[model samples]
Target: MKKLLAGTVAGLAMLAIPAQAQAQDAKGAIQVKLLGTAVLPDGKITEVKTDIVGLPAGTQTEANDNVVPTLAIEYFVSPNFSLETICCMTQHDVDAVSGLTGAELVSDAKLIPATVTAKYHFDLGGAKPYVGAGATYFLWVDVDPGEATLPLGVTKTDLSDEFGFVLQAGFDLPVNDSGLAFSVDAKRYFVGTTASWYAGDTLAIQTEHDLDPWVLSAGVAYRF
Candidate 1:
C-alpha cells in the first residue's frame, strides 16, 4: 500500500512541473514603446484662369519631410498573445518644390491604433525575439490647417479631417525577466482628405487627396 501511494505521488508531481512552466511562460504583463516616422507631403491644389478665358501654366507640387512621435501600451494575455494600443502625434511643414517661401503650414493630429495578435519568440539561447500582426483604428483630433499664402488668392485652405485604418507588425527584445524590454514596429496608415481653397470666405477650388503614411517605432517597456 505504501509503495502504491508513493508511486502515485511521484506521478502527480511530475505532471505538475510542466503545468507550472507553462503558467510561468503565459503570465500577463504590461509594456510601453516609442515610435518614429517620416511624414511625406502629398502636395497642394491651385486654381488659375487666363484674363480672356485661357488656362495659366507653371503649376508646381509642394512637398516636405516631417518627423512624427508616438507612444503605445500592450497587454499580454499569454506568452504568445497580446493586445496593443498606440497613440501618436504628427506635425508637417509645407513648401513648394521650387523653394517658394510661404506661410509654413502645420498639422497636429492624434492617432489611436488597437490590435490583437499572436507573437512567436525565437529561443536561440540569447536575446528573446518576437513578431506579431493586427489591425488599427486611427483617429485625428483637432486638425487645424492655416496657410501663409492662399492658393490663387484664396484665404483659407481646408485640409480634410481623416479617420482611417491601418495594418501593423512589430517585434520585441527583452532585456531581462523583470520586464525591461525594447521594441520596434512598422505600420501603414491610409488617409483621405478633401482640400479646398477659399478667398475671404469664398470657395475658389476643391479636390480630394490621399495621404499614405508609413510609421516606424522603437521604445522601451517595463513589465509589471
Candidate 2:
C-alpha cells in the first residue's frame, strides 16, 4: 500500500508542472515604446509641378531636416496580441527662394496617432519578438509662430489634417515578467491642404501632398 501511494503522488506532481507553465503564459501586461527618425521629402506631384498660377520659375523650395519622436503605451490582450496608442512630435523648416530673394519659417507640430493594432508576438525563449499592423488617425497641432515670406506673399501652408496607415516590428528582452522593447515602424500618410497666397488678393488653391513618415524606437514593458 505504501509503494502504490508513492507512485500515485509522483504522477500527480508531473501533471502539476505543465499546468503551472500554462498558467504563466496566459497573463497580460502593459508596455511603453519610444521612436526616432529622420524624414525625407518625396517631392511635388505632376499637378503641383505644372501649376502656372503660383510662384515663378526662379522660386526655390526648401524643406528642413525633419526628426520625429514618438511615445506609445500598449496593452496586451493575450500572449500573442496587443493594442497601442502613440504620441508623435515633429519639427521642420520650409523656405522659398527666388533669384536670391527668399523667406523662411520654422514650424513645430504635435500629433496624436491613435491606433488599435493587432500584434503577433513570437516566443523565442529569452528574447521575444513581434509585428503589428493598423490604421491611425493623426490629430495635428500647429506650434508655429505664423510668420513666412514669398514673392507672391504665399506665407503659409495648412498641413493640419492627415490620416495614415502603420506597420511595425520589434523584440523584447525579459526583465522578470516585464521587459524592454525595441521597435521600428513605417507609416504612409495621405495628407492634403490648401496653399493660400496672402498677397494683394487672397488666392487659395487646394494641393495634395505626401507626409509619409518612418520611425525607430526603444522602451519598457511590464507584465502582470
Candidate 3:
C-alpha cells in the first residue's frame, strides 16, 4: 500500500510540473508576428454637398478592399495579460456616389493606422485565445481625386487625420515545443474623417466620411 501511494503521488507531481513550467514560460514573453491583412471598409462617406448644378446633395462614399502585410509585436505583462501593437499601411480607392442619381465620383487615398491594444488571454493548453480593446491613430495621406473628378474642376482632395477606437480577438496555437505558433486575428476600427474637395485654390465641398474598417489577419508568430 505504501509503494502504490508513492507511485500515485509521483504521477501527480509530474503533472504539476508541466503546468508550473507553462506558467513560468508565459510571463514576460515577447512575441512577434507577420501577418497578411485584409482591410474591409464597412462605413461610408457622408454629408457631401456640391455647388455644381445637377450634382446632388448628400453624396455618399465607399472604399475598395485592400490586402497588405502587417507586423504585430506583443509583450506579456503577465500570464493572462498582454499589450500589443499592430502596424500596417493600406491603399484604398474611394468612390463618391450621388444619393439622388446613383452617379459615382472615384478617388484614392492611403491610410496608415497605428493601433495599440491591451489583451486578456485565456490559456487552453497548447492554444491561447485573446480579446482586446484599444485605440488607433489614423494617418491619412496621398489623397488623389481620380480623373473622373478632374473635368468637374476638382483639383485637390484632402483627408483629415483622426483618432479611432479598435476591438480585437485572436488566437495563438503552438505548432511545436519550440516558440513557433500560428496566429489568426481580427480587428474592427471605428473611424471617421473629414474630406475637403478643392478646385484650384478654392474649397469646393467639405464632407464627413466614416472609414470604419474590419481587418482580418493570419500568419505565424514567434515567441522569445
Q: What's the lDDT for all of these models?
A: 0.56, 0.56, 0.83
Candidate 2: the clashing residue pairs are 60-97
Ranking by TM-score: 3, 1, 2
lDDT by residue for model 2 (1-224), tens: 99999999999999999888667755556777666655544313223423435445554444455666667777877677788777765565555444324455324534455555667888888777788888766565663422554443554444545556777776777766445444555444444332333334454433344545554555455544
Question: lDDT for model 2, on a 0 to 1 scale?
Answer: 0.56
For model 3, give the 10-residue run with minimal summed lDDT: 97-106
Give candidate 1's error at residue 100 in angstroms.
Answer: 8.3
Q: Estimate each model's TM-score.
A: 0.68, 0.66, 0.83
Candidate 3 Cα errors over 4 Å, as ranges: 1-28, 49-54, 97-106
Q: What's the lDDT for residue 144 in model 1?
A: 40
Better of 2 and 3 by lDDT: 3
lDDT by residue for model 1 over 1-224, one digit each (tens)?
A: 99999999999999999999888766646766665655554555343321221112443345455676766777777665666776655555444343344544333333333334444545555555566555544344443444544334645555556566565666667788777777777666665556555667766545554555566666776766
- After superposition on all C-alphas, the RMSD of every candidate to the true structure, in Å, is 5.0, 4.9, 5.0
Considering lDDT, where higher is better, how would the candidates rank from best to worst?
A: 3, 1, 2
Off by over 4 Å in 2: 1-22, 26-28, 34-46, 49-53, 57-63, 67-69, 96-106, 143-151, 154-156, 175-201, 222-224
Residues 1-224 of candidate 3: C-alpha lDDT, one tens digit per residue: 99999999999999999999888877539999999999998547666545443455555667789999999999988778899998888987776555533333446688899899999999988789999999999998688876666777888888889999999999999998778999999999999988777889877777677888999999999988
> In model 1, what are the clashing residue pairs, if there are any?
35-217, 155-198
